[model samples]
Target: MVDYSTQLIDGNGEFNVTGLDNFMKAVKLRELGLSYAVVAIMGPQSSGKSTLLNHLFHTRFREMDAFKGRSQTTKGIWIAKAVGVEPCTIVMDLEGTDGRERGEDDTTFEKQSALFALAVSDIVLINMWCHDIGREHAANKPLLKTVFQVLTLQVFVLTPLEHLEPVLREDIQKIWDTVSKPQAHKDTPLSEFFNARYNLYATIKQANWDASKVREKLRRDIEAHASSVRSAKLSEIVASFEKKLGQALAAPVESLLEASEKDTWSSIRRLLKRETDVGISEFSSALTGFELDQATFDKMVQNLRDYARSVVEKKCREEAGKVLIRMKDRFSTIFNHDTDSMPRVWTGAEDIRAITKDARSASLKLLSVMAATRLDEKPDKIENVLFSSLMDGTVALPSSQNRGIGDSADPLASSSWEEVPPENTLITPVQCKSLWRQFKAETEYTVTQAISAQEAHKRNNNWLPPPWAIMAMVVLGFNEFMLLLKNPLYLMALFVIYLLAKALWVQMDIAGEFHHGPLAGLLSLSSRFLPTVMNLLRKLAEEAQGNPAPEAPRPPQPLGSHNFKGQTQQPNTVSSSVPVSSVSSNISSTESGDEYSSPQLTHRRVSNVEQAESS
Candidate 1:
């Protein structure tokens, strides 16, 4: 067992982030005793998982911090105690995997995080990215597969409420006094628990299993315990208990613990199937209670109880949810926003905005306040707290009606922020598989270059010092530094030097020693013109980047190609309307043999996909 020392490094450290930030995080975790479980963020680079965690968990993990022209930013496991979280609830932000664009051969961190999560985590939350739910080879797939495989090794039978039945788990409490029937409801124990035990003993007997010495020693002890059994139910199980089946039955645990995950996946699948409708095999599994063995059934029943009771804190939530939501609604009403969905919560009343451009920031603020209030800790910075307030309903519209703002308007009146609904989180998915593929190709090229460099260097028996690269980097510094000196002010300094030379010539009685000579005048003229020329060149370059090499226009596509028009295609629909970005992209990119090239947007919005396929 790895000793519980407060020093295991997380992914942030893997990326070479150190110093005071690391020290403070370590200190906080150690003090709170919250560094036990590991929770990883799994997704492609720039997926906003880090941003979301940082925003939600109050972490300082930087999002997409790669310098211009750098490879992947996140390199390894970064551990930190989730801020505003309970003790022993550590969040291990893992380096996202399957960044095939980054490099293919090195998946050391991915493998490492999988093993770490399996070994240490009691609850490994696979954060369902609002996007990337169905894409094959999506960051979640490999990560989930690893989690599943390794989880096989560390199996313990746990019956959590969410495992057995989901419908019950989702039920809102009718009343507080009314018992939501204790969450762990495994009353009728599976008869198979006893039957399976009998079969195990029979298998052992058939194998001629024996620990003769242990049996002889325990004969009297067994008899004494057996006599104390009052009920026939447990007695039979106790008598038939054999040790070997523990290994066989461990993988599925309840088959019920999977109920939640499976159900969650299925729900996600259907939702994906409907929206982008990548139209994979329509074959889907239907849950049939009768097909499950009694042991499987009983375990399911038990798991739901545990999950609902503790993890979900179903009862306590019922009480808190009502009060908090009401306050949230008031804020929403004032802002003309929807109460149920804004983004997050605000710290106090003053941090709110009448109408703001920064929705993401607003949401973070809402979350900050809610989280802070929970722990009774003051929020650190109001800047991010703006975003958290989105969730708290403290964020709303400027008006009671659309296109309007001001007083007596519903705090959540106009409802600019569409609530996420009582279902899946809403986000814009950049289905840029093609873009990613292009990026992957570039990375692959770079990797090949790197490999060749390594081989050539090795063959030449050449050595490069760590500082040598630092020195080599100075070449870039030289180019940039030279460019800076070429600025007009520095050019003027050179002109001054020429004037000083002219003065010497005049003092020495040299011929034609004028300070205002044609040469000096021309130099001044060039200096004045150079800046404009440089500015023009920079602008041209920027515009070129902006318009990139006018993508080689392609032949028109067949009808259903994503190139076709969406709902707003009709001339009549153009009442000064813009095409819904998601639909427009789907229609637009379909024809381009290279489609997945969406600019990543981190802002959370009401997903039109869910609404589009609202079956």
Candidate 2:
């Protein structure tokens, strides 16, 4: 049902997709759980849904075989087990919806088949053209909507109560927004509720305001009122803020609030994302065509994401529970809204860093504390983990040395130091996978952090190339050649050579493959042109020691068998040249009492994690 394949190659009589090795594998999936994943072959009478299924599933339930009958063959859900041993597959060919009107009560199984298929399958592979994504009420649209409605309901039932809270709120808010809340019904007498609504407006209306103005106002106010604000209580600040908001709204005065900020789509997205986080994942039919207003959506999404994250972390190992308790205590103090922690200079950098750092720490601390509590241990150990994780993109001093990171060449420069728990035994492949995901996320996060600061770092992430990146690559590569020759004028000449090489190669392979596809794809990649380009970059990088290391390419990895689009594959050999100091000599990837490094940390960490359960 869920097609893991990317393409369906067309041929003389039918698609030549059967030539693919995966076609064999797919046939086996047809019967994996003994519950045949119902795949509905749907399209206009001639968009080739049936033809596609017949070829894909190897079903002979009467298609336009050219050698068979001329009339329409299937009437209801005609299913046949996949021919090959790919997997247990059920191919359900539904009557085409776009066919000419047969009779007044003539029932096509499009709607019914969709409902039935969704209930039973592990996946539902909707066969359609790439062009059908946005079409309104296209032949497959109703089927998709019905299936979605059904799935959404199932999701709500299976999920927990806290998970459903945000979804419920989103529905209510969406309805109120679309219907305008009847002008707040002349304001509630509850101060907490009123202020909450007021803050929501502040968040919405000021969403697009320039930071500079706000910074200036904050600075002036802070300097003028620092002495007077020393003894201000938490409740007092909230009250003051509410009073200011009420005056601003009643007077319609133009302050720092940005007029151009409020947008409807963001509101909808906020609500949608929040609902998804809370696991509601579907809207009540009563609010189907409703439009959202103001800041309703953003707040909802933010709240739900935060809550879902909280719930999931609480479900981690017992040790994580204790960590959450400590974090809650810390956050309660921070919630006092005291301005002392705020920076003196309102540089956007400080504000962004402080906010993000606090948020990240709070989240990790919560998870760690929860784990600790659940495991029945002191929450203090979580502090070490929290601090270590915060150093994700930065260097850490030796616990014994007590020196700050980047104390010399780059006191501020981030260090590439990561190590698994010392002497922790890796036990299972499943544990290995989990740790690997954490490592991969950390690596990608480092890259993101570098980019955020206009810094450079090495990471294996490679996906869609931005046009600017292509131009920058050419410029940087050509410059290396120009520098060697000491001639700036030769820059354009070198760039031309690069472009010409690329153009000639594109015409040679990609052009031929446009309609024929996959045929020329491998050639283009394996061609000398690509190799030549790669060689040129390697030379350039070698020439400049300052150049950032390219992400380790994963083209030929053995571990990555799934080959999903945009997924980075696992490589056969991993070679990293991290500083030896970065390796925790005290922390071994094994509990064998034999501390030594292998070619690299491969089977050792996994083995250690597995041992922890026994230890």
Candidate 3:
């Protein structure tokens, strides 16, 4: 058989991880889990602590020989499995304390081994010589002091019945009285301070190494130990499964939400059920070792499923909290770009009304998906209700219209849906209505800007005047045209003026400035027109006066080397001023109802507009 013992901690206080792993595997300790018990023995150097463990639990801890004289035997802490002990008790043989070899000043390892034993062991056996019991400076006194300083534990004193005189009992009581107690246990009695006293030597000698009584005692001790630990183990198991469920559901649910497909909730339900089923299967398998009854097992499994469902619900609610942001993003994605994901030019040929309806419909669908939990697969008319009520404006009749006979009541007038449970409702009917209003109000400006852009595109492309205006101009200017043709100098002057006007028009982006409206365009033109003309006049006058005019800056090279005739080129210009009225109107409309507006919403809208303009 494989040796099931190893030095757990070496003399230098380092844990032997590899040796411990091998020891655990040899002992099959993992199969015991939390059902096992730990029993540790500690005392003065060469005082037979290892011998006592070997006798009581049939362990193979090395013992000191009397012929070799008194010295340290066990170094650090050595652990071994009890061969015949019931419920799988593991025994620890701690290094002997107060040896002349280590010197008087060094008790660090002694105190450390004592504390480690008390911390991990369910039963600690302190071995001391019978003669040293009543001494003022007993070898185990300092060890007891260290144990007492950390935590209050039930101490057990084991001895042979023949040596257990009344005086020895008094010495044990006196030792307990001398050890300093924390304030919380200062008034406790000796009987309460220590576990029961036992004649361990007699018990071992009477049983003749059969260990039948020791096995029974160990079984009881392990049962008591398991009782205290079972609840915590159960909690740990549930907590681990809860964390796994959350991790499994997080990514898939987030992707489903972003896609916002028709069957998104159904997909999430399936995912949750699958993950929870896997968790419950593993959980039940783990609990099988515990041998729990049917009711308790069923309760734990149900709790796991409930926790998994709660995880999905929590994810839905968290995504619902960001519903407005998601809706805005969806609207932007559909409305700002075309089929190929290229930025739209808002050409007049595209139908703005149809595009706006399609974008709003998409956004509303997202809101509908998030409004409730549909894990039961029961289909509800949430999307249709929202479309008819909010998008189509067919749910809420006007007050006057409602006053008419046989007028139907508002469908979206309630706070909750008809079939949805309160626990499952992420967003209520009223909240959806309010959100739709805000979404429409916020998105209206994009549509308006698109319409304005289409108008501007049409206006900019029209190079020819109407036919009637052309006729009138030709008829009215016939005499002037003839006169100009008769004089070569006049015709040349007219050509120069035409060239100057065309150059100014191209350089200033005059057509772009006039696209806003008549009054605003006139104001914009008046602001820049006079200064441009005066600068041109000044430059010409200086050149005529024979003063060296500043060298004209060279134009940038065109992308193509060949220059084609009959095509008019327009200079690129970035407009610094955006029309303020459109911006103000958009902001004011968003703020018309304070109930729907927040500082964050306003700031976000402003930032989005700035980003759009920049792009």
TM-score of each: 0.22, 0.21, 0.55
lDDT of 2: 0.38
Q: List model 2 lDDT by residue over 1-615, tens digit each.
A: 444332232211133354444654655553343323334444444445565554545456555544453345445444455544232445556555544444324433456655665665433444433344345444245444455444421111111123334443343233333332235643423222211110000111212433344334433433333323323432353344334333323222111111102232233234334434334233222122222233744554344445443332233322222333344444433432235864233222344445445545554443332222111111233335334544364433445666557454322222221232321211122332233245336444533453454321111122348789999888888867658578756766878888767654542343333333455556545654554456346534744664334323322311211111121223332334654344322122222222223223212123344458757
Q: Top model by TM-score, which number?
A: 3
* lDDT agreement of model 1 with the native: 0.37
For each candidate, what is the lDDT?
0.37, 0.38, 0.73
Evaluate candidate 2 by giving its C-alpha RMSD to the native, one decimal: 42.7
- Pitting candidate 2 against candidate 3, the one with the higher TM-score is 3
Q: Output the TM-score of candidate 2.
A: 0.21
lDDT of 3 at 454: 93
**Order of candidate numbers by TM-score, starting with the best:** 3, 1, 2
Query: Which pairs, if any, clash in model 3?
Result: none
Q: Which stretches of candidate 2 lie over 4 Å from their true place?
A: 1-38, 65-71, 104-108, 127-140, 152-615
**Candidate 1 C-alpha lDDT tens digits along 1-615:** 121222245443333335435645644645543223444545455554555555445566655743454245555655555554343445556666766554667666666766776676543434333234345454245544455433332221111222322321222111112322245633423222211100001111212345343333323332333234323533343223211122222232222122222132234223322322211111111113124456854564453333322322222233223323333333334333435655433322322333322332232232222221111122233223233233343544443355534453332222222322212211111211122234334434433443454455443343345687878888768976687587978678778777655543332222222224547645544443443334334434645565323322222221222322222222221122333354222222111122221222111122344336645
Residue-level lDDT of model 3, residues 1-615, one tens digit each, is 334778999988999999999988887889877667788888788877887787667778888877789888898899999876666888999988888877888888888888898899877777766667666545466677567556545455655555555656675566677777778878788666455444444433323466557656755665665675688788888888889888998889988987798889888988988998999999888887777889999998998888888878888889999999999999999999888999998876899888888999999999999999898888787887888888777774454744757544776767888678888899998899899889888989988999999988877777689899999999999999999889999988989999779755754456666666668768766776665566456556754675534323222221221112122222432332443222321111111111111212222122344446768
